[model samples]
Target chain A: MAGIVEFEKHPADTLKVGKGFSLAKADPDATPGYSGNKADGEALLADLDGKLTALQEMLFAESRFGGRKRILLVLQAMDTAGKGGIVNHVMATMDPQGVQFKAFKAPTEEEKSYDFLWRIEKAVPAAGMVGIFDRSHYEDVLIHKVHNWVTPEELKRRYRAINEFERRQTDAGTTVIKVMLNISKDEQKARLLARLDDPAKHWKYSGGDLKERAFWQDYMDAYQAAFDETSKDHAPWYVVPANKKWYARIAVQQLVLAALSDLRLEWPKAEFDVPIERELVERS
Target chain B: MAGIVEFEKHPADTLKVGKGFSLAKADPDATPGYSGNKADGEALLADLDGKLTALQEMLFAESRFGGRKRILLVLQAMDTAGKGGIVNHVMATMDPQGVQFKAFKAPTEEEKSYDFLWRIEKAVPAAGMVGIFDRSHYEDVLIHKVHNWVTPEELKRRYRAINEFERRQTDAGTTVIKVMLNISKDEQKARLLARLDDPAKHWKYSGGDLKERAFWQDYMDAYQAAFDETSKDHAPWYVVPANKKWYARIAVQQLVLAALSDLRLEWPKAEFDVPIERELVERS
Candidate 1:
């Protein structure tokens, strides 16, 4: 808990790795929802942008050679947790060619009848593609627990199922990175209210949002249980402080780049067979 | 050609017609590459965001709904023409559940053997989903044309195929919005050069970038042909100015909102079927 506050209040430079990721401090002035040292966060984000571009180029290069490495980034969070802002700020700089995004919604009747992971399984990125999931299967734990949509026995079974699902994905060579955007309740309300007060933002708000707010404690309990149960070495969850969207986005980016770096992917050498002429080169 | 320039330079505020969209001008001085007059863009984006949210809610209102509507937005552009920025600034705010993104790459042998549209068809949004294509099948026209992938006769056939493909999509209730990010050649070179000069941006550049730059004239010729053949009333091209990334994003948002308004799509209704509980209101 102290680690969380320290990261929230101090610069990222001050962070020392603890058991897993060290939470960085949020910059108050960087952007309305952003948290981190403004200058440091900007620099870190810039670095991330460069790294992601390289990763993307490499992925595209891989595609050219028919090499496929599917990567999945799962962002699971409470509402008003800056998931949207995070996606905009962090993934904004990557080349579109190699990246894909999906936002998991409540299971439809058709989906509800199937296993929890069915819809999500279909969303995994194809070979040489990066897929970002905004609010994923963990919803079963977060929403289902709050709503009592299933028995504790069923929920317990799901934790094992999700673990197996992710492990299978890793075995299949799909790099899975999970992030939990953890913001406090007070901060969550402020954001929700912001959406309600602004007409332009009204579309993002709904009557049901308040209903979810009422179960804040229940959600926290559910999330804690989830992290305790499923934080594996392969697909570990980075507990991001959503109070500052900027720091969270940067943290996520750094984690992603770090993962891709581990893969040591290379760009494909172009095999251009197109007619080449001095005139075309100069004119092109 | 002047009409192209005129349309390119037009600010988003002037374009706000109906459907709660008001063109926004970003404040130029807020930060480098950060729009200052963002309030207006936010307003317009928020309007579209709300409309999209309403549409999704309508489609998924039923827990056991059988069918869903899908929308695909295709963005085709020259290098340094702000595709990434537009995706972040305009469409980034939409709920991820209702939206999907696919960035098509150079064709693999499998894709190359099939018709040009084969890979593109694989990425179209499912019903109730909004699919965004960053650089799509049009690449065969723009880049392939410049590189002479096929003879004039073959290229001509591709144009008709593209026009018909989008038409069939709209007839199937898929709202197809296409944008051609048109930037002056000088502007593009400036951007490319910026990438070269800035160490942080160097990774974004490649050797082929200059080669492609040399073929500017050829690309322009190809794009002109594409525009002439495919700019039908249903799926017209909005030739946006690319010099100002913020303005271009706003313009694209305006075009998207306009299409949604024309469809007169209604918001999904919330079906409250569970028994009312006193605690639910209290908790909320």
Candidate 2:
């Protein structure tokens, strides 16, 4: 069993990338925080639902009540690594009004015309909202790096640009949580085959998935290099073990809870007198 | 029961504005496509789930199969008119992988740096995907016009710019579905008060919502003028009655189904010989 876990420190500190972090060295199935069976993990996740919802609500209220802080959860992974599942199962529990979800696709002609981050900047969650990027600006570094889409010097410039961009977001009160859902290639193959076997899931089965699977090693290398360059104190990357979908969801929910709890958000006091407002409501 | 309804023509043609469209003349409580009670409407919405899912899947598949067509659903509504609910209930029913949902908030420093359509053009749904804009480029006309954020001449220029931008989108095979969620003033008051009453919902209650309420008529005028200028054969605006949430959801679902159906999508054929692939799979 794992040692007694500290809610604030356990998964985040351990999952977070340190200097010279290697994706190859990290196990994709490790459940660092919880030493329990699947049922226990699910129960823990269920308990986290209310806590996450409450923290998100507070953060959202604070935005309107003169709190300028916001949270951005960036989920990056290989195809079929459960990024959508995290958005749906975990983040959806929060009030839809407070969550801003942006799924970045390949750049359009106009998007390519600008610096890569322009579209990303436009989609950042406002104050007091939980902004989720299903796949984010990190794609430019990861995929582009894998395919040599940019020159080595240009890629270096992007690393600098990404750091600067994230620092600016932090300065503007956006707490950025970057998570890479780490799943083994074998696990991905199983999931892909499962989709193919189910007729209803065929729409999601893309030839592109197999094409991308062929480049698995290249992607891992790209991820390693990206972590080496861009994982800063302001916006560090957390490698969440996603083979166990339940654990990944719970870990993400806990990370979010920790981030919001760190903010120490309180419901804003009513600007008007409560006694008078009660009487006024009675009169109305 | 109401008279026979043509799914292709009824709501789209009836709800669409003429040259001199007046917001005041449109009733917020009307349910055009639906001729049943709330329960019945909900049942229809429930029924639409599978159909919409199937259509969306095909659309997504067609994209990967070399189809360049896409659909963009642009939702515009007054405060408390249930845009978020529609997104949650209607669009969320489809696979998130194929949907690109963008909620446009107030312009940021970088967004403000570009022309009004610059950020919007960057977010158009990629091929074979369903893109939803919670609030879109139309805001440049609606809010800006109501508040005189732009001069009359500038507003006229913006109208021209918007029409041109949408035309370009249409020419590029993006079928744009523009909907205005029409709600009564009383409905807005009740919805706003409901938020005030619920502590959990307090975060969604914004002071700007009330501030905008003060200029309700100005907003109506802005909508009327903008709709008159921008609604075209290719991208017509549909003023959906949103007071009945269930009815509104079903109506939007039908419209989306109709749009996808118009695409005449078929299941993409497998590139490999099925018999050969079957043999290989059987051996494996």
Query: What interface RMSD does every candidate have?
Result: 7.5, 4.5
TM-score for candidate 2, residues paired by index: 0.70
Per-residue accuracy of model 2 over B1-284 as CA lDDT, tens digit each: 43333243467667887677788999999887556777776766776688898888788888877898999999999999989878877887776667787889999999999999999988899998899999999999999988878998999999899888899999999999999999988788777777677666665656667778878899998888988898998899999998888778878887788899999988776665444433433333
TM-score per candidate: 0.61, 0.70
Q: Please name the candidate that would achieve the greatest TM-score relative to the true structure.
A: 2
For every model in order, the TM-score on chain A comes to 0.82, 0.96
lDDT of each: 0.66, 0.83
